[model samples]
Target: MTNTFSPLATYDRDAVRHWTYGTASTQVPIPPPTGSPYLSDLSFVSGANGWGPVERDSSNGEQAAGDGQPITIRGTAYTKGLGVHAAADVAFYLGGNCTRLTATVGIDDEVAPYGSVTFALVADGRTLTTTPVLTGDSTAVPLDVDVSGVQDLHLVVQDGGDGNAHDHADWADARLTCAQ
Candidate 1:
């Protein structure tokens, strides 16, 4: 058997870090900033929460299905996104000083109606990268943002004003790198 569980990234002097939300079993509550309402079916978990990459039209309580392990680096399977619910947020910290952050954002291959969600990276109240709209797993949104002298970052995925309908998002190959 393979050890599918691992941290988002393995740290080193180069000050590299990664974020794979569902790799571990830590469940953190994600409340909206202030006026935004809470999105449903979003949380942290390990493995495929028995969800494939398809979102249903009706509200049968099946939001977390389409997300599972994504491509892995080295030998570790990547973690799922933080939402079974439409919108999800995760707190990120870098182990070492870094100048840039990069990642690929998309809805899991197991989910459907991908156009109903949008993934973004928000840092210090600025929207760094926001995908127009995802329709399927065929495409992954690539985001590279300048994080020089920055401390905190927020990974967010939101329902596209469609009331969280079939919104299963994922952030893959998330990495923080320093200027070399």
Candidate 2:
């Protein structure tokens, strides 16, 4: 037996916006030809985010690296106050389970001068292996961490250096895709 219902709708080809940062930015929705088109109101927040500036052993710079970059979701930094990291809203759910996460960024002057976009896998609200921090120099630092056994996976953000603050992360957009 087959049942019929209204079909899922797709946004206008030019309706949805894209944002990004760091280098080779092509995802963020810059000042629109008319108005703001970069804002999102999608449901489902794949997050375990929390951030606060503090003096690590060396009261120098901040963290813009792994797990750190993705957690920053402040809109005041943007032209229209759309949050600092653009990728905080964009996400994908797939395979009846896994929810893939992706992010893109655009650099500006307000960002910390030294840091890297950090990604971490959290299980049962516990700390896991802290992988080597990823620097802005590396783009699209993707993680294939199996979410099949996780209920909470977090992506944090911060800077990188020999305990010195020099780099910054001007984020723009975030997107997600998965195959469940």
Query: Candidate 2's residue-wise lDDT over 113-175, tens digit each?
Result: 334544443444554433455443444333434444434344344334343133333323433
In model 2, where do residues sit more than 4 Å from their true spots?
Answer: 1-96, 99-114, 127-131, 161-180
User: Cα lDDT of all candidates, in order?
Assistant: 0.49, 0.32
Give the alpha carbon lDDT tens digit for every residue of 29-138 in model 1: 33222221111222222222223322222121343453334432223334422333356665454323466766666555555434366777766667777888665544
lDDT of 1 at 27: 40
* lDDT of candidate 1 at residue 91, scale 0 to 100: 47
Tell me each candidate's TM-score: 0.52, 0.33
Supply the global lDDT for candidate 2: 0.32
How does model 2 score by TM-score? 0.33
